[model samples]
Target: MNLENTLAFAKRQDEADELRDFRNQFLFPKHEDQNFIYLCGNSLGLQPKVTKEVMSHQLDNWANYAVEGWFDGNEPWMFYHKELKKLIAPIVGALPVEVCPMNTLTVNLHLLMVSFYQPKGKRFKIIMEGGAFPSDQYAIESQVKFHGYEPDQAIIEVFPRKGEDVLRTEDIIIKIKENKDEIALVLFGGINYYTGQWYDMEAITKAGHEIGAIVGWDLAHAAGNVPVKLHDWGVDFACWCSYKYQNSGPGGISGIFVHEKHFSNQDLNRFAGWWGYQENKRFKMEKGFIPESGADGWQVSCTQVMPMALYHASLQIFNQVGSFEKLRNKSIALTNYLEFTINEVNKSLGTNQYTIITPQDPASRGAQLSIIASQNGKQIFDGLMENHILGDWREPNVIRLSPVPLYNSFEDVFLTGQALLAITKKILKSS
Candidate 1:
């Protein structure tokens, strides 16, 4: 479909969208008494309307029952996260045992790495994508240092060939093969935060396994924005935070996946804690740590019920919408329409400054498009914000706009494009 010259077409698509009504389910932040055009789901999603209700219920339970709320209530705090697995499983395409809602994203990453990144002798280096999120980079560097190995020696980063902004699947496979001997683990983001590039998780897993390296993924940008198949992909492990595309509010609890293959491995050593103990005998105050089976074995502490409640409420909406298949279908159409509109506006302005750094191929990205305004990047970004279009600016020049499927509409995309066109003209004239 030709996206340019297509406002009518966009309206038609929105009218027919099965998920269209979901836009009203979110709480939009306002500016100048207008609902802001929120296109920042890649950074932080708009809060779901149900968040307050869910959070309040948990709060009231806490207020009335105190310590008894842990086991006495209808939705007891002790097992609050249990309801989340089925809702979350389909989003990541993993079995219930393979995933759990707990901790923050980077924390879970460190824990998963501790178990999977068992670097020994020469086969201990980790292969990751270059320019990953700063938090992820720090986690990997610290993990390497903690292992008594220098970061440079234990971490191997694969970058795109010069001039290209995104990595190719073929290059990643080649890198996996080249470092087969030294690489102990292959961990990278499912969708890159900066470039908005979605990596081939299944292919990456296959390549890593071929070299006898365990494969893990940081899916912070991918989990709700795209489809994943951690179980079918044979990924060794994965972790994700729910705050972004999942719309679980800031610092919402994260999740982890441990492949079923690891469940029976008694020899796998982990830093043990009381919460990881078998549920039936957990309160026995046993002298030895007999860990629970499956992903629960990785639990390091008591579950955070408040964050889990918020996450659970958001996840329930995903369940109601069915699968990522349905949500991702809308994502492609919405983002493509936005790209088309932006390009059309760019042509009218006679400037090529706003180039989309995200790949054009739908398979290579999610809803987010990293637009690099070559001239006056920050100025244009500030202009967009002042006009109440809430896309975020990253460092030097890129403004990341994500048309989130669940709570964003076609009109939102159209309005933002128009706002951007006006903003660009004003910025250029003033500059």
Candidate 2:
């Protein structure tokens, strides 16, 4: 997979791409006089052309049917979430019954914890990656406190070795084994947000289960960026937001997956709402909760119709593409090209100006390459933005660029490299 640093080579690769047409379906933001090279799909995705139309249709139903919309219309409000389940099931690799489009990511995390994070006797500890997304850190800490345990005593965070940027699989497994006795749950992000490391979920699941711990994932970065097999991996439960790689609008609907093994477990508790009641008897207004079977049982409220509609429009694109395998193949190549181009920049400069923190192995990471800028990183990031080379910058000088398979072209990656090289040169010359 040799890569060239020329725009012509990138255009040639784009010309040969079968998924090239997908870029047209998304609406890109304009910068100066042309479309900005958007590589921030790791943060927020571009809107689909169909999203507006689908949203209008739902709005029209609301205008015409009002409360009756719940039971009437083409896609009845009552069962709309079910339609999303069918489209999303394959994307996350789960049976339709095991998945549901529901509450936002953190809310679902808390709700699922009530059922899965049962601590008893000496087993009250939770193991997670050190430096997990702040939301997860907050959620885990709050859950520990709510259960009457101190955060410092109840949580174990596994970190990379002092000099390494990514966690080794052996280190993570060893930590789980060492804390096997006191662990009540092992919750981790499927992909670490800052480093872009995709953990070995199957191995983690097995290790946690050996210790009699429930394992779950916060897959905000992993869901559509990389291929996941939650059902096959026997993951206890998982949740994800659709706004990132899934291309749903900002604050889009989130999804949850609960393994079928937990469906019949009567001891598992849930904070229920009317929508989560058994569908047939829901209108009966019966007392005592009879949760709708499967993951839907965890729902605490009715669907957020507008957001779900936006998400559905994006899922349609995924459906048209057929499978995540094709998207994943292109993702690997695109990220690889970006990595190669960045390395070439460093070599040409005769110094390591950019250090990629993301794992080099395609299997160990997704589309994102988190690069640590060696000098004037913030100024370089500003230059990229001014040039409409849209990548995100984190504090302390890391720039994350993700070339999405569905909407981003190889040319996008090519131009991004050019911007980085140019910006770095200007910064060094002035210094």
Candidate 3:
């Protein structure tokens, strides 16, 4: 598609968009009296209009049923997550039984490590991307330490070649093979949170399995933003937070996926809780832990009803618009428009005032474009906020803007570009 950088073009695109009406379903933050052009879905999504009503329904159930809410009520607390599982499976490309909603992102990562990160004598290292989200870095660091292994010794971090901003697939695979004997687990984020590079998950999984290592992914940014076939890719386990692209509230519920192949492996370790017991036998309250079949067996506690309620609100939108095909198409177009608009900014200013660090290929990224302002970077980011354009700013100097297809319009991108141009012009004049 030949991209244009004008408000008329953007409004035309939005007007012709089949998914345009979906934007009306969300509640956007206002600046003065106008809505802010929210380009921060990679960090946090806007609240769905339906979130309040659905959450209130759960609150009403609590008031009406009290302690009996577990068995009674429309969405029984005992099995509330069951419907959620069905909603989540397609989004992450798994069977309903292979996925379960529970815990926070890092908590689920730790729980999964308990079962998957069993390091034997010779094979005792975990390999992952170097600049993963801080949660992953902290979680992996602590997990290795808990297992009585030094963090530096037990972890192999694959880094981008110096001068490059993203990891090449070849470099990652070569590193995994180099440590084939010592690497017990291969862990990676589905998409690098900062650079917005979507790794070749299927290729990485195959390489890990070929080296006789268990593989996993933290799909914090990729779960709903990009396509993933976790089960088909033979990824041993994976987890994601619903608050970002999925549009659940802040610190919303997290989800997990365990392939069906791992279901019958009774030797697998887990920190069990009452909710994870086999359904029929749970009420009997017996001694030994006979785990519930599939990923549900990994649950360490009962559902967090309110968090799940928030998550369910978002998943319902994903479900209503089956097969993320349309959303993906729109996402690609929106991101491309954003990139084109940014380039237009640089061209107009004739100084390359903003540099995009994210991968150029649509296949290698999702909705986000991480840009570094040539000068006064932080000030430029602050300017964007003051002008009612909400994007994420990383330390040092990276402004991450994500044009989410669900609620974002082409006009939002156009307006953001307009604001960015003005901000850069003002900053250049000052300095």
lDDT of 3 by residue, 1-431 (tens): 77888889999999999999999889999978988889999999999999999899999999999989999977899999999999999999999999999999999999999999999998999999998999999999999999999998999999999999999999999999999999999999999999999999999999999999999999999999998999899999999999999988999999999999999897888888888999889989899998999899888788899999999999999988877989999999999999999999999899888889999999999999999988999999999999999999998789999999999999999999898999999988999
Q: Which ranges in model 1 have alpha carbons more than 4 Å from their true place?
A: 4-7
**How well does candidate 2 match the true structure in TM-score terms?**
0.99
State the displacement of the C-alpha of residue 250, model 3, in Å, after optimal TM-score superposition: 1.0
Worst 10 residues of 3 by lDDT: 318-327
- Alpha-carbon TM-score of each model against the true structure: 0.98, 0.99, 0.99
Stretches of candidate 3 above 4 Å error? Answer: none
Q: What does candidate 1's lDDT look like per residue over 252-276, in tens digits? A: 8999999999998887768788888
lDDT of candidate model 1 versus the reference: 0.89
lDDT of 2: 0.94
RMSD of each: 1.1, 0.7, 0.8
Deviation in Å, model 3, residue 25 alpha carbon: 0.5
- Order of the predicted models by TM-score, top scorer first: 2, 3, 1
For candidate 2, the 10 contiguous residues with the lowest summed lDDT are 389-398
lDDT of 2 by residue, 22-66 (tens): 999999999777889999999999999999999999999999999
